[model samples]
Target: MSHFIHQHRFPVLLFAIVVVVLAMTYIQPSGKAEAFHTKDELDYFALRSNMDLPIGGNGLFKASGECAGCHGFDEIGFASVDANGNDVNVVDDWRATMMANSARDPFWRAKVSHEIMVNPMHKAAIEDKCTSCHAPQGHYASKFMGESHYSISDMLLDPVAMDGVGCAACHQQSQDSIGLLFSGKLKYTTDVLYGPYDAPPPIFGSPMMAWVGFDAQYGPHVETGDFCAGCHTLVTETIDLNGVLTGNHFVEQATYHEWVNSIYVDDQSCQSCHLPRIEDDVVLSTGYSFLEGRSPYGLHYMVGGNTFILKLLKDNISELMLTANETHFDTVIARTRDLLQNHTLDMELTAEGIEADTARYRVRLFNKAGHKFPSGYPARLAFIEFVVTDAVGDTLFASGLLDEDYNIIDRDEDYEPHYDVINHPSKVQIYEMVMGDVNGDPTTVLLRAAFPIKDNRLTPVGFSTSHFAYDTTLIAGLALTDENFNHIDGVEGSGTDDVHYHIPLNGYDGPLNVSAKVYYQAVPRKWLDEMFDFESDEIDLFRDMFEGADHTPELINEASIVDFVTSVRQPRPTERLKAFPSPTSDGFITIEVPESDRMQVTMFDVSGRMLFNESMIVNRRFPFVVPDKAGVYLIRIESQRAVYTTRVVRQ
Candidate 1:
């Protein structure tokens, strides 16, 4: 009998394996059983398929598709419609946004691969933290099932993970310590779906629970900026090149903190702008005839500054395995472009009058957003494109010109410094943040970033350096010293920048036409140079897509003046005072005056500190010596007629 049992043991083991496989395959939800023949087969299918599977986890969260049946587009009841009777279903609008496709974003995939490639030792930590925000459903659900790490490979195989930032990722978030949880640390409830509205009647709520296995409850925290801060306020731990932790944390992104320091903190929230509210009454879900229309419906557009990625997704819908069609992407793209061009900023270009054969214009940019203009990712940037042309469209002076590849021409090798006055076309006024490594060298790698080498991005209105949150959103580089940057009369929180342009006429004093435009780039070429240098499958895929797409920067705002004549012959009182030997080596400068009345002369350092002030009587030449320091100094000459400010370089 013992010999017979041993001989049949192999057959019994094979039978047990078959039984386990059949149970795993057949024990899925009612509708998903037909999707796979075996557990191994399903994994193989998901690995190759570009489309996201309609599979929810056995843990806390469900895939976004589970909520689509009730909240998606409805032909009969016309649920989730706007004031114009147009369908504004939550699922449809969100399906095409960066938020919905966060996990599927090629750039993000490539960047994750790049980071892991740079620091191979910390691959587990990198993927765990990155997917916590980008692929929250998969990451957290794995954690719920006692898994320590959810890798990029695991995300690719799991349909729930590929759902990116699905409905459950936000709706299932717990109100406990939401805003206080920085980085990807988010707490989710076990079986609850939270919305802005109160608990629904059992008639609708019972069906929702049956369909998605979650009860509908009201969560006021969903509409708060602090709630969004869980992921938006990212603080990453610094790591050395060899993947060792440096014991220092870097504020990779502080968008929420930037908003807290602004005036909009009192009145506006993240949902107010991204998920715009509509006053029209509309039904929240379909298949329920007794459902009453709700007021102040929030559309889930989730619009942001990433039009470049949106276009890439639209162009390669089939390749990316995206659910949204071209038409859906077009709608989101149109709304995003509208938000960027019409609502992001306000620009005014005024001719301050030409002085001494040079055209003087002031370009003032007012940040209209709740946070910084180009907030969030460090790679995003905005720049001024100032052009002075003659009547025949002959370009006289042009700054911030882009080459064929959409790179700003003549940009500094490392990074451009913040400029109060741009006298040369090579000096472009770019509002961007540059990251520095442990050695104070410029770097694109986020893990190696020690601090912000330069962060001159435009601040929002009411931004103050003394605000509690300002340390995380502090302004860096020369912009800190720029008097006209976010300051008025030496007071902070103006939230505007005044860039003065002094273009040389070069003896051609014809009527000049000045055109100034603010251009924005989500992914500038300079930011990609380092990433493209490293070779990987994800990086190569994105490189092909990015290289094939149009690289033109979006025009945020523009202002133009036509047929402007300069009064060079009849110089103003302030224009008459000219300083000879501008770059004075000996610190002694002679100010040639027009023999005017007694004037008030003042000297100020770049930081707006008054260095010297005197009431002097100028006969013809008034000589004065600047400080011994070799730096740029502002000279202000005020007569009874007018006030003039000029910059002098002391060597």
Candidate 2:
């Protein structure tokens, strides 16, 4: 990469030589000390400074116990940065997580804490849209306090900023203040601070290159897609029509500018294929606590289609699901069924794209994705299905549905070829989907979550649809059928695995009798938890909807295709070691190795194993303490092949 950008151009021009080399070593003290430039300083000589502004996550979301001194509070999870022997915490993938209950998202902090008590001027614009992206590294203006809830370190009360986005709120960025994202435009590293160990920083950190949070990553409108468009590009103002503020508008919640006008933005960029670079692990993966000191690695708990938060962080629901008499395992995957298998429903009773005096007839279902066809996270849900037959194939017609605002809508509901988070979101959800009138009873109100939530737009597998209608006799025989399809989990597609029985060739042409196959499923998180009333039985919303009931409705109710490190997998990487430092820093990471080589040290997240160790080896560079409550981890130091990867920065 241009000799790694010309060996980081003179170590980032030495922060313009930190004002003449820290004022010629700032008043004498050369016992070999360096680094510390401003944006606010602190370094009792140099115990690793790292102070490139953001003012200590707004005082650790205004409660400063200094983020568990290394985030290990009440022992939550994810801190396996630098370890000697045993210390792992992704607290079983963040115990009961939604980023550890993003501080209880009851309709998004109870409608912005009730609009910060009847709107205190939109309470810092709803606490800056709920801390940029759930405390995008905490300090959300001292966790907002307007409602009063304390318990900092990963949020307990109104640390509105301490919700999910943690870790010194994004490796604490640099490069002249990462362009001050959000209200600004966007930027991840304008001056470059990427991670994975080039070491030294925190002795008043950043000399243009500050990310020791473990490298591999940015900048230039941050590689366009506007660095994920400052929280997927959105803006919302209130008190419109003469009320003054004039509804500031701006819209986008994740079309990411329709993938920046896509053709995959000419050649992809949102970190090319979603932060991919980990030189082949079937589909990118790495260790040493996420991209640490770089080696073509980047991924770590960054999966897509949200899998309903990876099914509450890995309850797996028995490897997503299966049945049809357990079809003798080997690997088939297709649980709860949503999208993948070619999407189906081609049609031809007359209208192909519909709209000319249609008695309900339209078809063109297609959805493709090497990744991001509603891939993961942003509330996934795919669509399309029109089965209207007549001559003996049975079934007259049918419309899709899953509603309660899960909206599948039917007419075979081809909700724009699928790929979502929002296209309607109950007419734009800012938070209020309770509508219904003709005496259906939802009282009133058309929409509100705050308005503008769903709009995923579609067209990934070539999404492009318009001109609709399918009154198809209201649902002919109703039975595309599915009890528990089969299996094929990892996901990729060509479409068509069974489920194709429509005889409506209303325009057939011989040999084109068309026969196809491709059906698979496993979905049984308790039969989709009966079918959702939702209240969390410790979150098994039928195992978080088979991580989106894959097989496709955009892999409905999704979660966990595993791999938050192999879906809670652990044990592998221990050079018979140890360390010890835990006034219980959350899960307490400190073990020491050298008691007779037979080592093992482990910690896993995304739901599975909690801690592990095979012991013996009392000393080799100890200082382990990471119970959890931060993020990004995976530390394996096996003695077998002599593994020794390192990357730690817990503060």
Candidate 3:
């Protein structure tokens, strides 16, 4: 019997395997039975199911609507209202901001689609990386559950993703390597929601956990600039035009690094200006009547200098599925306008009396923000519109004038260079960062960008070229050579720029009226040209929106001197002291002190380090051998009447 069984065992096993396979095919779950089924396919189904769940039902991220229940405006006045009864609700303020509508930003969507069209092979990588910040909740949630490549399709379908930078996205952020880790490298805790306030007593916290499935915990990092750095400091890989990796990276936006290099780093966080603290103690949660009114309440208006996109979002609210309405958007836009006009910059326009039939005026700009003025996206720019008119309102000279389509009329063929002096109407001073491709030509494609061709954006106070973060927030092109761009007496960190406008009087100098204005454009015409050239659904949609919308740039600041006449002034000996071969290639600079009785001259480097000091009576030109270093130097001359300082550049 044993010998018979051994011989028949092979046949029995084969028959059993066939029976089991047939049974499994007929009775098993249809998903498991499919031959081509992959883990991603299964996970996608699960992801869809989780996303479809009502609000807080999802195990990880909850829809922002869930938070709106407590944080939104309340008619009963129990929460979110200031002492003056102004409704400063968190959800209402945030909903209208670019941060809230980041996912719905038509320009960003169009740009992303444009990049994908240019580099089809990198579609997956681009979508995944972009959604990491824009649609973080959905992207991170899917990634958390082992799903790879969160695409735009996934973002559109997921309710959490469409919420943009929602409550959970920021509150659930884990305080781990925040400032150090950038470019959407964010970490999150599953069920812990962070806030600037300390953890509520168990009585309040328990309800929060019960209501939203998240424990409200104290997280000081939530109030830090480093927390925002996770997204603000973006460094992207450089790719060739043919979709090949260039083995280099570009600092796409360095808002965080720019702040770190400025004077405000020690005193202010990103929240200080954007969020705006309210001194009145105010209730944080609705229905918690016994809860003490919290002090230092920050309004959740996370606005930047992107009023153009905000207006676009407002106009197309229904199309974008925005939670905020038209009125909310208008309120936010007004706030943004105020921020750009009052907080961003300060300008002083002075008439440097007419000289040689050429009326000279100096426009000095001081950046007051924590970072560079017009920082963040490289496309943003602020240009000075200087105009001089005759007594009867005839145009004498005008630079930085825009065409009907909002494109700079006098913009250079490639890009405008930073100018210390503008003698002609064609030369305009535009504060912006221009990206260049491998060929050193300007390119709007982020992936193709190899380096910055021109980045003369106004730096913040205390911004130094020698700072550790200066490499990322560099002053490129002609601005690097302009001594007055961010320097005073060759000392860096002035956060100011002086543009001397030498407008020709043209024999008509009767009461010249001068007006100097600084205008900012987030979605500049030049930036739109490249993106519009691409044929895609996103691009088409954005083009339609842009064409229909008003293309007026926001007036950041303006100054005017009405009815001014050139007058002769008494000249001093110090004013006559001339420094020849200003940007000297040789080691020596000739100082011609015309009427010098006894004068002390001192020389300093860009860092304010003194190099030489000499006191001598010189009536004629003398060659003073300067340090042979190739950089900006400050030369100070002291006489009896005045002390004068001028910059000398060594080539």
User: Tens digits of per-residue lDDT for model 2 on 176-240?
Assistant: 43323543232333222333333232222221124222233332343333444455534344443
Over 288-334, each residue of candidate 1 has an lDDT whose tens digit, in order, gives 77788887899898999888999999999988888777777888999
Ranking by TM-score: 1, 3, 2
Residue 506 lDDT (model 2): 38
RMSD of 2: 26.1
Q: Output the number of the TM-score-best candidate.
A: 1
lDDT of 3 by residue, 173-214 (tens): 988766878999888898899888874443367767876778
How many pairs in model 1 have backbone atoms within 3 A of each other, for residues 3 or more apart or on separate chains, i.e. clashes?
0
**True-structure lDDT of candidate 2:** 0.31
lDDT, each prediction: 0.83, 0.31, 0.81
Q: What is the model-wide C-alpha lDDT for candidate 1?
A: 0.83
TM-score of 1: 0.80
RMSD of every candidate to native, in Å, equals: 15.5, 26.1, 18.6
* Deviation (Å) of 250 in candidate 3: 0.2
Comparison by TM-score, 1 against 2, better one: 1
Deviation in Å, model 3, residue 319 alpha carbon: 1.9
TM-score of each: 0.80, 0.25, 0.79
| Candidate 3 Cα lDDT to native | 0.81
Of candidate 3, the 10-residue stretch with the lowest lDDT total is 1-10
